[model samples]
Target chain A: MSKNSSNPFTVPEGFFEEARSRAVAGASEVRRRRRNAGIALISGAAALAIVVAAGTMMRSRTAARLYDESAGWLASAEYDVFLANELIYENGMDY
Target chain B: MDRVDQRFEKIVQEYSEPLYWHIRRLVVSHEDAQDLLQDTLVTVYRKLWQLRDPSKEKAWLFRCATNVVNHFFRRKKRELGDRTLDEYLEQTLRDSEYVNYTEAAGVKLQKGLLTLTPQQRTVFTLRYYDELDYGEIARITGSKPETLKVSYHNAKEKLKKIIEEDE
Candidate 1:
């Protein structure tokens, strides 16, 4: 059998032309899908980064506020202790 | 079109018809062959960079086509539960579009070809129809040239007997 030998199969008229077009189109579609997927992956990574940054900022702000409140409470408590000592001393309650 | 797209378009123009015939002979359906050819070309586009040796490009395309056909039959087998590949092909030949039914000998030849094992069928078609040498067939099929020679011989004998018996 040779390449020119006839086989039983027959394609539709103009099938090869159509097949070439379809193949080119199909390859283009694959490239398009890959591009879309790459874009989506990058977008997803970016969105994740933004979410992480926002969460970190919010957490840091909350932490700073909590630290300020704790320091203020400590200062007031120290002043009260000092006042109590002064009252005791002023009240002649020292041993 | 960029360089890669231009290269791919050239490939599609060059190899589509031959690949289509190769796949049509194996699958025995124009629609299936078209779909498989498209898949093969798409695969070639995706993996073209992996082909280092331009001299082996034809063999590589055929190899891709052969893998696609194998995958098709595997998926078809799973879908067809207990119905053999032969049965499926027979049904496809009977009902598929774009087949030349007027050529009784050709149809009989295809049936005979289908009776061979998948390896023998592939080897025979690549050799007999595509006129590929044993080395090229071996490259496409990943078989030793001697092994392909034996398979092709066996397939030829079997098909001869089948066609003669039909006559």
Candidate 2:
């Protein structure tokens, strides 16, 4: 162990260049990360919109089906009552 | 693009080489050192606004770098099921390519450094390699100046003893 007073580490040639490149690369990487995050946000919004639209469409279809069925049932019920009244009138059973 | 961003880049360019060496000495591997240095700069970029007095940026940067190194060890510890930073230092000595201490003194000095606790190693590196004053180191390490002085004093004595023991 000789006089170990001076700094013991020695860097390679072009070390500064290498470090500079790293910082530049790091900055670019930051930009890339931000871009990816933005893309993720947009996709999330799109997914939410799709979910909302699908839910609305399903509700509309269900309401339409129920409306048609109820309308048909009402028409048949009205026809049945009319036939019963006519029969009563024809047979003279007015009571 | 803006003034702050411009200043940040200037800081990166100015400090990268020295910071790399500082990290290299501690981490003892090129890849790890490079990764840590970049991570440190990224943090600096994000947190430069916290630095109210721009003149004290160096100490702030060092503080950030130390935290990054500590964070790396913390992550590694969790991954390895509780490996200590001192143990990591001991294991990585064999992997350090930057240690060109083919000479006996350099080799002995490195061995002595590795033998120290993580805190002592950091204190020594800051004092000897970086030539930072105790007050500056205190600011970076968040330790009292008196405590840093004591640590530096003991670290120097231990290094000498270890080196001399080999002779």
**Tens digits of lDDT, candidate 2, A5-95:** 4345555678668777777677778768978999999999999999999999999999999999988876897867877898898996663
Error of 1 at B60 (Å): 1.3
Model 2's CAPRI class is acceptable
True lDDT of residue B145, candidate 1: 99
Instruction: Judge candidate 2 against the unseen true structure and give its global Cα lDDT, from 0 to 1.
Output: 0.79
Q: Which candidate is the best by TM-score?
A: 1
TM-score of chain B taken alone, every candidate: 0.96, 0.91
By summed lDDT, the worst window of 10 consecutive residues in model 1 chain A runs over A1-10
Model 1 clashing residue pairs (backbone): none
lDDT per residue as tens, model 2, B1-167: 77767888889878887787778777776678878998999888777778899778787888888889878877877877667666776666655665566654665677688877778888888888877888889988888888988888898899889877777
